[model samples]
Target: MTDEAIRTERLSKHFGRTVALEGLDLEVPRGEIFGFLGPNGAGKSTTIRLLLNLIRPTSGRAWIMGVPVGDVRAAHRHLGYVPGDVALWPQLTGMEILTYLGRLSGRVDTAYRDELIERLRLDPSLRARSYSKGNRQKVALVAAFMTRPDLLLLDEPTAGLDPLMEAEFQALTREAARRGQTVFLSSHILAEVEDVCERVGILRDGRLIEVATLADLRGLNATVYDATLDGPAPDLSDVPGVASVEPLPDGVRVTLTGPPGPLLERLAGTGLVKLRSHEPSLEEVFMTYYESPARPETGLTARLDR
Candidate 1:
């Protein structure tokens, strides 16, 4: 089998007049957690459905574990998916639904399934229709995780979950990756994905805009630092890396464009009292793409590690 968990070549999808995803060429290597990021209507959900072969692509093709996605049964055996919006059999209990799905996957590790259910705090005795959104999400997550397939495709899986459950979900991803399962995390919550994913692919208006490692994403935008001073505030305006310095009531907020070494050296003797540094969120790093499509030359992608 190929080392690639997923490979898409010019994958395009259309629905009548609307082009959902366009000419996307991407590869997700084995044992890597890849994040697919885009805002709603940016074709994030459409792309997930296409990978699951729930809908045929208008053009191009996709492969899962070196098996063409067109061969749904074979490809699906190696994939576990949680859609952005989850649905379950209304007449069945959560336990029944999971049991049915486990059977369908043809590899039901009953002990692991029960462990996930308990860890997620799911009351599976409740009928599917009676479960709240968060409970339903828990059920779906359990179903996906229990199988422990080769590839896990989670599209906005944390929605409807509380902070506690969200934390659990993140932990589960780490566990999955540790077991050598490749995770394809698709979400608009940039920070959530950035916390666990090694690589990220940003999609905008049906196109792949940028792909970068987490470290590269850190430098793709300027860093913001806030400092409180006991002594006279040093003039950071001329510092080599300082982009802009704005005065705050208590102190000044400095925006550093590149290396922080120059700024740190300048502040050494300034008698700093309290200082806080903030890294730009992935969204903030690529706001240009989300904000405007007309301006195509963002030039920020040049810094990404290819």
Candidate 2:
């Protein structure tokens, strides 16, 4: 069994009468990129704050590297974090800010810091106020990535990055994973999550509703298949694995759940001349959760350490 970098059990928080997080159970395994996804007002930031122990939880437990969250200093030692919105001293240079954060992590090695600066393409002389949104974001990323922590908690990590820089960010994340670092990345970008995350947890109304691998999610939804047959198309209404089938004069369309292997084999017997298959987007899979109360197959992988 893989060791977990972070675990939360029935973790909850309330701001007076307003509920922020309710029983948010999550697990991030060592050396894996775990994506935390939700829309606006879905309690993503609240959960991060709770895990950092910046605010006390109303109920449940949160642990970092098997240690309680309340032991903030000790727990933070093995972690690096980049917030969605960065606030920095207007007068301070980017390098100065990074150095400060590095110092906070207990040691400031010049060689590693310089390597991060070079990789991020950041200039040390530029003041915070002079930087654009992308540059500011880079500053924060450089700060966190420079530390080389065992785990990374990134919230809206690509907020201001352009396509090229976003690609660079993805490369950096994969590099971290290669080196056995755990990442819990929060994002609204479904495509980004699908690209890098091994598993994802979808949160709604402050509660975790689903957790699944990208392949698993793709398999759960309808897959589009278009096929051309030599003879008049056969009625595929009763075909197993197919959710819907549309028949045309020379071809047929079918949608299926789970693997396409069995469906392809069956289509072969139909004298198919051409066949095509397509998987749905993350948005489509997510819609299924909202369409009803039914949850994904990987319901809960972690117990609230409470």
lDDT of 1 by residue, 1-306 (tens): 999999999999989999999999999998889999876777788888889888999999999999999899899999989876788999999999999999888897899999999889999999999998889899999999999999999999998999888989999999999999999999888778878999998877788878889789667657877888777778876777564566777777776666888887777668777889898566546553433223455322222211
> Which residue window of length 10 is worst by lDDT in model 2?
297-306
Residue-wise C-alpha lDDT for candidate 2, range 1-306, written one tens digit per residue? 338898999999888888878998888889999999877667888888887888899999999888899998888888888899988889999978887777777765678778767777778899999998878888888888777888889999988888888888899999999999988998878778888999998877778877889888777677778888888777655556665566766788766654677777777887989987777667546544544223344233222211
TM-score of each: 0.81, 0.79
Computed on alpha carbons, the lDDT of every model, listed in order, comes to: 0.83, 0.79
Off-target runs (Cα >4 Å) in candidate 1 are 225-278, 288-295, 298-306
Off by over 4 Å in 2: 225-276, 291-306
Give the TM-score comparing model 2 with the true structure, all chains together: 0.79
lDDT of 2 at 259: 63
RMSD of 2: 6.4
Instruction: Give me the candidate number with maximum TM-score.
Output: 1
Which pairs clash (backbone N, Cα, C closer than 3 Å) in model 1? none
